[model samples]
Target: MLNLLQIEFHKMRYNRATKIFLIIYFCLFFSITLFSSIRFNLGEINFQLAEQGIFNFPYIWHFNTYFAAILKIFLALVVISMISTEYSNQTLKQNLIDGLSKKEFILSKFYMIIALSLASTILIFLVSLGLGLIFSDFNEINIIFSEMGYLGTYFLKLVAFFSFCLFLGVWIKRSAFVIGALFVWWVAEGIIKGILTFRKQKYGIKDQISQFFPLEAMNNLIKEPLTKLGIVKSSIGVVNDVNIYWYQILIALIWTFIFVWGAYFLIKKRDL
Candidate 1:
């Protein structure tokens, strides 16, 4: 695994496009996170949650996880570009000719996906912890540790989202087309969700199926903390509003498996 990762990094070292994407991704991630943290810490935005310690221990996990999740698209683009570049350059076939098994090639990409997701999650965790310590009052262990499940939800969302992107990269084999299709699919799903929601409200329809959409399922894994901060209304009730749903996490896991399996199947069966 280490050797495979090393090879992957070695390839990335010479890839100008990969470097450019990564530079933009890190800049965007840091800029957004730092700006939000500084703004909230400085009281630039008036909100009741800040007083109740929304940026404080425990609660900070929820806020930070959400902010970090917003950057997953960058990671997705990284995966899409990497795999698609391999396809474009015919490196995948070259590797196979050089005695690398198909499975190893796919697994190597998966290893990179896991490593990137874990690194990003841990970095955001540390950032959130540091900000909380510097700005929030020391509270009880229970209060400081509660709602940490948001971190797990955040991690799951990244892995699932990236796996889906890998599947798209393998299936589409074109960076621009895959990325554009992903954007279009996301927008289409949002439109379908909205239309279904409107129908449910206006026609009194009982089908609540919109949440089952791939991205929507991943999103339902983490509800909006702003709603709990009294900034937005809870679609469900306040009692169950801030909590992460196990079923949603299960759905995300299932979809992650499907996307991964689909990618492997397509890669194995198709000609390079």
Candidate 2:
């Protein structure tokens, strides 16, 4: 099992798609940090204002929330490609024929996803922390860590989202379709939810429907206090009373098990 995992890791390290994803991930983080640093240095942002307790903490919070949200999309792409590429290349079949158990194969892939998610989260957090230190001396580090309390919940949500994407990739066995469907689902669902909210005369039933989408639920899991931007009501009508941490952990686990188990069952029952 350990040897199989090593081989999997080696293949991932050499995969061109994985390399491109890492580059894109780093570029996104670097761009965010660069923009924030420039804004701070240009006198466009007043440090005293931040220190005066007017918008300091919320500013940091908003940055973190937006950063996480953007990174989530890239992470989803990485997950999809990781699973899809193996099947597309017929490498998964070769591995299976070489004495790798179905359980080991699936578990290895899932473990890699978890490791990647955690590593990306930590990388972003550290980069943001360094930027905060470089850009200001206003004790934003504490605020960053405070906001980081959502990392674990968000990690679980990523796992669930990745699991679903993996299942889709396996079921369809087409990279273009899997990637296209993910983006379409992400954009269309949000748009539909928005239209529903706009059409609602009083109630928020449309928003409730949107809340069930994996992306929305995942965002709710990493509920950062900073990005509320005065939007009071949650998509599910939970309002300020929502416990995103608990909700994310619960739903992510349930969905992760369901999708991964379903995929495993299908793999075992079907000929690859």
Candidate 3:
């Protein structure tokens, strides 16, 4: 596994565009802390986000992970670029000629995906821990470590999403079109859910069915964290409360397997 990742990173190391995108991705990720300085002044209602206690111990874990997942699109671009270039530069053919088996090639890509996800997960843990220590009201060790499960969900979300991007990149072979394909899949899921709910008197079936979709499975890992804030209800807007369930992690894991396997199957069969 270590050797596979080293080979993939070696390729990325010399790719100027990949390096630039990675730098930009991390910069945007760290910039998320800038939310602490956000202010909202609506006539007689003045509010500052930093005072909202979102940076509180357990809450900071969920908040940071949610936004880190959002910044994942930048990494998705990197994933697509790597796969697209492998084909465009004829590296895939060259590697195969140089004695790399098809299974190892796919394994190498999957290893790279896991490495990126693990690194991002560690970054979130450190950043959230730092912010919580500085700003949280409770210093109890239990409270500090309470919501660490969010980190797992965040890691799973990245792996699944990037795997989907990898499948698209290998199948489509263009970064722009891969993104377009992602958007189309997202829209299709929404449309399918809409049809399932068209003038229906119930939402249970719709919700249950939508949960099976790839993107929906990933989204279920982390529901919106913003609505959990007090100011959102008192000032921002009325919002519904969301529950965090452990089963969503399993759903995401299954989708990740499907995506990675699908990509591997494609490369195995294609006459590279």
Residue 66 in model 1: lDDT: 84
Candidate 1 vs candidate 3: the lDDT winner is: 3
Ranking by TM-score: 3, 1, 2
RMSD, each candidate, Å? 3.2, 4.8, 2.5
Q: Which candidate has the top score in TM-score?
A: 3
Clashes of each: 0, 0, 0
Off by over 4 Å in 2: 1-4, 40-62, 136-144, 195-200, 203-209, 223-245
Better of 1 and 3 by TM-score: 3
Mind giving the per-residue lDDT tens digits that candidate 3 earns over 1-272? 78888999999999999999899988887777766746778999888666788888888888888878999998888899999999989999999999988888888988898899999999889988887887788889999999788998888899999999988998998778888999999999999878776735464543467778899889888888888877676787867646667677778888888888888899998996
Model 3 residue runs over 4 Å out of place are 38-47, 198-206, 233-241
By lDDT, the best candidate is 3
TM-score, per-candidate, Cα-based: 0.88, 0.78, 0.91
lDDT of each: 0.81, 0.67, 0.86
Looking at model 2, residue 170 earns an lDDT score of: 72
**lDDT of model 3 at position 28:** 85
